[model samples]
Target: MSNAIDFISAYNTIDSRLRAIYRGKGNLQFSDLVRRCAEFNNTVRKYEDDLLLCARLRNVIVHESKKDRIIAEPCDDLTRLIGHVAELLSMPPRLSVLREKNVTGIDAEATLAEALVRIAQTNYSNLPVYRKDRMIGILNNRRVVRVVGQALERGEDVDVFLQTPCSQILQAEDMNRFYRVLGRSDTVQEAIDAFEDNRKLLAVVVTESGDAGDRIVNLLTSADIPMLIRILEE
Candidate 1:
């Protein structure tokens, strides 16, 4: 009984927050809050299943008469469900969790050898290549290997090939597959979606407003998704 009450309380809290968000967006109608939330791109679109389940549970508890109690004993699953809903509603994790002060980048003028040294020192597979302050491309091991392999196949001197500027290795056709820029306010689910949707996406760069020109706040790779799921589950 206590657990059921707690679940109801959790649902109410979630509903309240959703209502606030809706109103903030100039949506005054609260008759269909769950549907409104579903339509809102920035909030709860990914958690529609969980939200629907909570709505059904809320109905059961709210409509139950004093003489009849349908949810007498709440199990661990119920507790976990409520916890997830609360976390999603109250404080979903953002890209800032991955933010770092020092993000290494290779200058477009830098030699492949310089980029390789940075990669060796940091063990970062994807290094953003910049020209002045603008990001031109990413310097990853696969691209570097491909470029160097082609050079070797053409009988180019290995020493000379290593001195090639980072800009020469950036193929115009392949830039879209390398990385994506996302806003700092974007939810972790959006980041995961970006990776899952793009088979060749190497990294997600978090910036102030998801603009390519904004200063990158953090970087996320495919390996971070599992860790992010664990964090969300907590």
Candidate 2:
């Protein structure tokens, strides 16, 4: 609200939610913040600002929990969780060498089968699908089997079935603005959290000013973030 991006006193601006978040710093992930906060009455939703912030944190918690294969339900107070998320989201994202993504991209015109072969050769879980210099979407290795199975079911050519651009599968928009948006950070956790917060946002797109706006770089599930985290640690 101050337009200064200082969340240090964001709690002072809000109600008891700040207290809730401050109280639960032990469970640091986003979903836990939401789950813990959800246990509180609906009071969190009353503060529209706090509610929206908590929702984003919730997404982070849910996503990370799934990636780690944790059976956590994240039960904490909502008001506290909202404040924590507010502070966290206001901060810029962290980046890694993976975020550097020194890898080459594939053309959208490539056949699905060809792309699969390339992906296989590289041993990557996903490939960045690009239309020229612009990143379009991601081709996930896991989807190959499903595509093949569907091809077998429909009696269609897997090559043709998969020849389309990866944008067809980009759960978010393709934009240049997201490129390097995460910048550099002190920890992999910060970078991972940033990806969770903005991976599906307009920040993924490129604007007419040649800026990264509403742009998605490549799809990086919470799973990918951890891998980057590991790589960064090494």
Candidate 3:
């Protein structure tokens, strides 16, 4: 069959399989349901082996039909289509279990010298800076290194070459403010939103109940949030 035909057929098969599973093709015999697993799996496997569908099938199964009203179990077909959600489920957070040499700080001026030191010491391209419990800016390793060389050649004080604080660099005239902060007790999802959407990677991790949001117990860097999420999600 043509690529387009095969593509349509695959989607139809997924839809048909879901309809059969949930729409009560009225509860087949247990033995018959087991047989259905083999037949459905074989059908899905054929499409999975196709050149175009091999990779595309994974994405389709994952993203498509998510909101569709259907109840399906961990059948062989699903295993063939998705290939063990358990594998991805088990991937440890790249953030947690990562080295924590990058220590905590506040109002920390990111002189090029200091930024360079942190990058070299931590072997990370990004360094989080803070100003007395407030996240100030990220010291990018590449930029800091490049700007330091240029400043030094001119006999300039590299410390004076610090980039403007992150708020200044990322000020949003149109975007509304996000006062949505995490108390030390807040769920990790809050941290993820701040990191991904708010662009506040080195954002403040606050404690609300204690000191009534005045105290800063921890810092939530982009690195830390993802590490936590990897553990939670998988």
Instruction: List clashing residue pairs in candidate 3.
Output: 107-130, 107-131, 107-132
By lDDT, the candidates rank as 1, 2, 3
Candidate lDDT (C-alpha), each:
0.75, 0.47, 0.44
lDDT of 3 at 141: 46
Cα lDDT tens digits, model 3, 4-49, are 3344444444444534533445655433443444343322223333
Best by TM-score: 1
At residue 213, candidate 2 shows an lDDT of 30
Better of 1 and 3 by lDDT: 1
Superposed by TM-score, candidate 3 places the C-alpha of residue 219 at a distance from the truth, in angstroms, of 3.8
Candidate 2, position 188, lDDT: 42
Comparing 1 and 3 on TM-score, the stronger one: 1
| Candidate 1 residue lDDT tens string, 1-234 | 467777777777877878865665555433367677666433466666667777776676667635565544456687667667766778877777764647789889999999999999999988888888877777889998888899899999989999989998887666577788888888776787787779788888887888876777788889888876665555
Model 2: per-residue Cα lDDT over 58-99, one tens digit each? 445545655545433333455445445454434322343334
Cα-lDDT of candidate 2: 0.47
Overall local distance difference test of candidate 3: 0.44
- Cα deviation at 153, candidate 1, in Å, is 1.2
